[model samples]
Target: MPHRKVGSSIHLSGQLPFKDGELLGQGVVGRDVELETAQELARHAALNCLAAAVQAVGDLDRVRIVQMLVFVASTPDFGEQSQVANAASELLIEVLGENGRHARTAIGVAGLPLNTPVEIQVICTAV
Candidate 1:
């Protein structure tokens, strides 16, 4: 809920995969974080993003994903940032259908805040 208001839009911080103050996917994304786990984390991150958008505008139907950036906390050997990011991508596609299709950037990082395997920063616009 701690977001910035900007002329019919609200900016949100990067969404984390935390539940009850506990971080999800504590290890590296491409190593300890399995495909399913990464996907789940991605889904959770997308949901969090959508939730923020909805809360800001008070209408799920009017929100659209403009872009999303996914950061994978992984080992240097990890090379599947796209796959990990797909978790969030697929979920958004499923939820919002065609409107969910978005421009995205997925990259691997040495680590993420809270040590979560995946972190998503989403940009949305209200219709």
Candidate 2:
């Protein structure tokens, strides 16, 4: 597969540490909310994360995705990892069009960096 460069390397920061629909930033005491499971990441809307990752690279036209590795933090019995992975897959497809369709692996792990529900890494052929 050929490598295509779509955007520059940029880091996106400032992710809230809770599920979607949960209060963010400062709140009254005893009102703190948290995500107890990985599935919550989707509830918080993973498409946003996916967009951020894609944006970090810049122009999507130059992107020819070769492969995608989607990691989901979940409980041992959680069988919905694939569903969560689909969130990223769908986002990539929407952003990159036909070129976004590529080899992919959706995996469940005991944990992830900062208890995040999902993390996506990609390999692409640069134009």
Candidate 3:
């Protein structure tokens, strides 16, 4: 529950996909990871960020998204990073309307915690 504010932005702790006794899967390889499946995973990771945002600031309606960074575990041959990230981008836009449209970086990383196929970090301006 710790937060730091500097200028017009708030930095949040790393968040992950989880629920009561459950978590998004791990051990996914990018080459074998379907675009839709990766997208779904990205969506889940984004939802986790939303949960963190709500917990940190108590609302989403007042948020104006500024940036989102999505990291994916990639196989050497996998090249659909941007497509996979669309899921998170679309979800935010769907939930936050114009406020959700923002810059994004979709990166293919060697690996991630829990081996989750995707991870998300969001930055936004909050009222």
lDDT of 3 by residue, 37-122 (tens): 77887888887777777666679887777888888888878888899889899999999899889899988889888877887887
Highest lDDT scorer: 1
Q: What lDDT is reached at residue 35 by model 3?
A: 78
RMSD (Å) of each candidate, 1 decimal: 1.7, 7.9, 1.8
What tens-digit string does per-residue lDDT give for candidate 1 at 3-94? 56677656767998866666666888657778779878888878888888788768888877778999888888878889988889998889
- The per-model lDDT (C-alpha) reads 0.81, 0.52, 0.78
Better structure of 1 and 2 per TM-score: 1
Give the total clashing residue pairs for model 1: 0
Candidate 2 runs further than 4 Å off:
1-58
Off by over 4 Å in 1: 7-9
- The better-scoring model by TM-score among 2 and 3 is 3
Q: What is the lDDT of candidate 1?
A: 0.81
The residue-by-residue lDDT of candidate 2 on 33-84, one tens digit each, is 1223333444333344444445655555665656666666666666666776
Distance (Å) between predicted and true CA of 108, model 1? 0.5
